[model samples]
Every structure is written in C-alpha cells, then in structure tokens.
Target: MQSNTVDVFTIGFTQSNAERFFNRLEKAGVRTVIDVRLHNTSQLAAFAKADDLAFFLQKINNIRYVHQPLLAPTDAMLKAYKKEKGDWGVYEGRFLDLMGERKIEQRLKPEMFEGACLLCSEALPHHCHRRLVCEYLNDKWNGALSVRHL
Candidate 1:
C-alpha cells in the first residue's frame, strides 16, 4: 500500500430505507459513520435520529457513529442557500469557503476517515456538502484517502 491510503465513504439516507442504509455501510466495510449535519434529530430524519442511529449502527452493524457539526453548514449559510433556490454552485462555493475558514485540513485527520462513511440527508451527492467534504479531504490529504459516495 502507499504511505497513507485511507478509505473514506459518503452516504445519504434520503432515498434509502433504514435496512438499505445499514446494508450499504456494512457492504462497504464501514466501521464508522460520521454524521455531517447541523441537526441530527429532525423529525424528518426519523430512524436516522442521532441517538437512534448511533445505537442501531453499533448494535446492528457494529459501526461506530460520530456527529461532526463542524462539517455542517451554519444555519445562516443554509438559509442563504435555500433562499437562492437551491443553487448548488453557490452553495458549493460558500461551503468551500466555510470549510477553508474552519481549517478542516488541520481539524480532521486521515485516521478519522479510515473505513468511515460521511452521512447526510441528501439522496444524491451532487447537492450535498458531504461530497464537498470528500473532495476537500481527498485534495487536502494528498490522495491519502479514497472517497466513495455510497
């Protein structure tokens, strides 16, 4: 293997049922699920509720769960993006800027991503910050991690 080639994954539960979601992670050999959301307990989230997910992941799949709010966009940023009619390009730009300011490179380590999956609500990666998180980490880690959007 190369010097540091960590395996990182990203998954969204919007289009997936609880069973399918857990299946995906298990199939991918995911050991950790890093939740990148501002609020993980939203009613719309249902079974994916932070505490419930944590328990289910561990009990059912043996996957550890961690919520990293720093990876989520601020409420203000989210509001602005929605106000723009879901312009993904603008949201991407603004989110990237926020990530830079947060110095995500320094804050997150390759170890935190090894066999880990980034979780969010967007069914597709196109409009999700989890995709950006993967891209940003892939670049910052100098290709040290392989990111797969599940």
Candidate 2:
C-alpha cells in the first residue's frame, strides 16, 4: 500500500471486554464494521450471534454492519492451510476474486465514512485471518493502504 494514501485497521474482540471494545470503536469513528468470522457465533454470549449484535449496532445511527461469507475462511481452507504455508494464501486469493470479480469493493466500500474496521473474535491481528485480508487489500491498493490495531 502506498504511503499515506488510505488507512486500514484490524481489530479483534478476543478476550477483551466487550463494552470497552465497542466504546473504543465508537471513539475511532468507524462507520462500517465488517464481521469476518466464518462462524459469527462465539462461545462468549455477548458476541455469540450476529443478529443481536447487529440490532445493538443499529441503535447507533450512522453505523452500519455487514457480513461477507465469501471473505470468511472456510473449513477447506483451514485444512489446506495446515498442510501448506498456513499463511492464508488460499483464502486471500479467494478474497481477491470476490473483491474483483464479485465487485465487493464497489458494492461495500465505505464512502460516507472516514474509516472502516474489520471485526472478528480474535484480538490479535497477526494471529487472525484479518492479517491476510489486510495484506491482500494492501497489495491490491498498491501500498495505498495502512493497517492499525485498535
């Protein structure tokens, strides 16, 4: 991604206090939150289901939520990763296809907001698929993308 062109931030809810997480997001002025978890359900009750979380987000006007199953890493990808680089290359390739062929960038790119954040259950970006996703986006955008952890 080009230096100082656009910024992309990755954040996780892993073991973090939910209230603090949401509050930090609010403080960050994120307009759109994309949930990347293949299984949106979490063992933790607060982040368990998407519907309830979406409803809570709706209460905060101007904040939108979306889930992209295409972007989510599949079981097959996980299994393959175990035997391969385990760097999420396969999933990143699929994500690029979705963004390019499926026109996900055109359909879901944030325009009204200054920033967006990808959401998942893991708190560490490097340990999560969001790192690969961010790397893909960074390459696609030709270094115009920046990633920050929140």
Candidate 3:
C-alpha cells in the first residue's frame, strides 16, 4: 500500500449470512468495521445487529467495530426513499447535501478509516450511502482513499 493511500472498504449485510460476512472482512484484511447505518438494531438485520455483530467480528475475525451515525442519512431521507418510493436522484442529492452539511471531511479523522470497512444493510454498494460516503471522502482527500466493496 502506498504511504499516502487509505484502504477503505464498504459492505452490506442484507444478502449475506454471518459466515460470508465475517469471512469476507477477514479475507479483506479489514481492521475496523464502521457501522454507517442510522439504525443497526432493527430485528430485520438479525446477524448484523450492533452488539452481536461487534462481538462476532471480534471473536471470529479479530476486527474492531465502531458505529458512526454521523455517516448515515437522516431517518426522513430513508423513509422517503424506501417507503415513499421517492426518486433516487432526489434522495441522492439530499443525502449529498446532508453530508456536506455534516462536514464529515472535517469531523471524521482519516486515520480512523484506514483499513476500515463501512457497513450498511443494502445488498449492494451501488445504491448505498456507504458508497456515497466513500466517493465523497475520496474526492475530498484528492483520491487518497482506495475504496473496495466487499
């Protein structure tokens, strides 16, 4: 790895079982798993529940877990997109604006994300805020982060 490059990863647990998820993180050399979900304790996210997931990650993969709701979209934004079936473009724009407002580029230390994987509930990264967060920060950091989806 280049000295100036940050190895950042993003993953979603919805379509995966616990075995696959933990194995992927372990294989990817992820040191920290950053929970970017607004609500991680939902019953639907069984294997990915905050407490249990953290415990599993440590025990199984020797990985650390940290939840940062600051990287998540507001509840209203999620409801509009998921429940109301709102436009992706509109929701994405609002989310980008929200990220700008949060000033994550300034607030989140880059060192914390080094060798870190961003976690969400989406099955894939294309439509997930974790992807947006990665792209946004990479831009801010002049492409210093090399983002990989797992």
Candidate 4:
C-alpha cells in the first residue's frame, strides 16, 4: 500500500443498519470519517444527524468526524452534469473542481489514513454522488482509491 498510490475512499450508511456499518469501519481502522451528505439528517431515527453520529464515534471509537458541505454536489451542478453527461456519466470533474478549489485535497493530503473513509446516506456507491467524488480523487490525486458499501 504505497501512500502515493492511494487517496481517499468512500462508504455509505443506508439500509437502516448501523452495527454493520460501524463494524466494517472499525475493522478498516478508519481514523477520520468525512460526511459529504448535503443534508446529514436521515429518515432513520438512529442515524438522524451528523452531530449525533460524530459524538458516538468520538466517545466510543475516537475517530475524527467532519461534515464537509463544500464537497457536496449542488443542485445546479447536478443539473449541468446531467445535461453534459447524459445522465449516466457521473460528474467527476465538477466535484474535483470543488474539492480542489476549496483546498480539500491539500487539507486531506496529510490527514488521509490507510482506512480513511468519506460517508453518505446512499446504500450503494453507484446510486450515490460519492461515486463521482471517489472517481475524481482516484483519477486526479491517487489511483488506488476504492468505494465500498457498508
């Protein structure tokens, strides 16, 4: 696992299963969890908000948590992407631009761990914007990034 070969990774927390998600994250040894969901509140009462999740993670596992709305895709950007990519081509560039301009890459470069993971509320990576974020980070910053479901 070369540091230059791998960038950030992503994971989802849908399907109403917290035990499985947290277990996988713990097993992965993820030290920092970045939540990219525009709205962190979930319909599922348990995972309702990012603050609560952060508190739990910090108190129980000592993992750092951050909610980065700048990394979240905006509605305008999504519409433009849909038009440009014809709905299926995930808008990787827009997100990359957002993260890059906001210094997210610079900020994350030093914080990235072997098990760092970006989180959202989509069950599957393909069904979520996280796919685009992961793709951009993998293609532009590092090549070995992986997106997984938990």
Model number with the top lDDT = 3
For candidate 3, lDDT tens digit of each residue in 99-132? 9999999997677788999999998988999999
Error of 2 at 22 (Å): 0.5
Q: Quote the positional error of residue 10 for candidate 4 in Å.
A: 1.9
Model 4, range 1-150, lDDT digits (tens) per residue? 564454456777767566777777787777878888777875654753787899877876788898878668876776676456535444555666776787655565533534567888767787567776666556665565644544
On TM-score, who's better, 2 or 3? Answer: 3
Tell me the lDDT of candidate 1: 0.88
Which of the two, 1 or 2, has more lDDT?
1
Error of 3 at 132 (Å): 0.2
Where is model 3 more than 4 Å wrong at Cα? 1-3
Against the true structure, whose TM-score is highest? 3
lDDT (CA) for every model shown? 0.88, 0.65, 0.91, 0.68
TM-score for each prediction? 0.93, 0.71, 0.96, 0.71
Q: Which ten residues in a row have the lowest lDDT in candidate 1?
A: 79-88
lDDT of 1 at 14: 88
Off by over 4 Å in 2: 1-4, 60-62, 79-114
Writing each residue's lDDT as its tens digit, candidate 2 over 1-150 gives 544565556678867775877777788777777778787876665743688667766675366778767556666665566456566556566655644664544444333213777887766775567776666655665555566778
